[model samples]
Target: MLDPKTGLPPRFLRTPDAARFLGISIRTLEKHRTYGTGPTYRKIGGRIVYTLDDLQGWTENGVRRSTSDETPCRVFPARPLTPAEKATL
Candidate 1:
């Protein structure tokens, strides 16, 4: 659904506001999205949107008591190599 006032998604935050909520710059957020490390997002009407809950939950993924604490970030697997592909490598 669209917001009657701004015509934007009503419940989710845009990139800028979501970035502010996370205390990060828009570019960083964009990079996260590119690298599959950012908070969960929805592609509504072909536009990106982030819910408050998802943002908060993903943020908690990095929570730790000490600076050295290890928190895993999302990662994607590389494409599988075929028999011929393996020969090239």
Candidate 2:
């Protein structure tokens, strides 16, 4: 359940919130829910619900590690180097 006093979204998230937390599209989430391939969830009073810990575990398992620190993106010069520019080398 969500904690209003803590300013946290929820320990138990609905479908949409859970999908967003997992960095997956809602359709994919639904597919997972249908297939029972994803993390643990509950059908509370006929509505699906997920826990924060379950989502965190799912993220840890399937996440793609970021290489940002090792290699960062950069923009190149807009203009192409001409033959004259090459000659300078």
Candidate 3:
């Protein structure tokens, strides 16, 4: 469907589409959701959906110039954070 504001496809994407857009497997996306480590999503009428902007923003969190770069924001794995990791956040 086209978005009234942008005259393009709607920004919202379902799980599989969102995962493909991010180049990750659907199972990985599900894992991220289960662990609460993925992009921000909306629950609309019992469905979970991600916005294109949110997907891009989440990927941007992992951007780095070098291995030693220290960015405050990061895109973590699709799993629970350890105590030490939680402390850093």
Candidate achieving the largest TM-score: 3
Model 1 scores what on Cα lDDT?
Answer: 0.75
Report residue 43 deviation for candidate 2 (angstroms): 0.8
Deviation from native of the Cα of residue 88 in model 2, angstroms: 55
Candidate 3 lDDT over residue span 24-70, tens digit each: 99999999899988999999999999999999999998999899898
lDDT of 1 by residue, 1-89 (tens): 56899988658898998989888888888878875767889999998999989999987776678877655543222234468954643
Q: What's the distance in Å from true for residue 85, model 1?
A: 24
Could you tell me how far off, in angstroms, the CA of residue 21 lies in candidate 3 after the best superposition? 0.3
Stretches of candidate 2 exceeding 4 Å from the true structure: 1-9, 63-89
Per-residue alpha-carbon lDDT of candidate 2 for residues 1-89, written as tens digits (9 for 90 to 100): 44769987676889998988877777778877665567678989999999989878865553445643332211112234468954653
RMSD vs true structure, all candidates: 8.2, 14.2, 3.3
Q: What is the C-alpha lDDT of each candidate?
A: 0.75, 0.68, 0.90
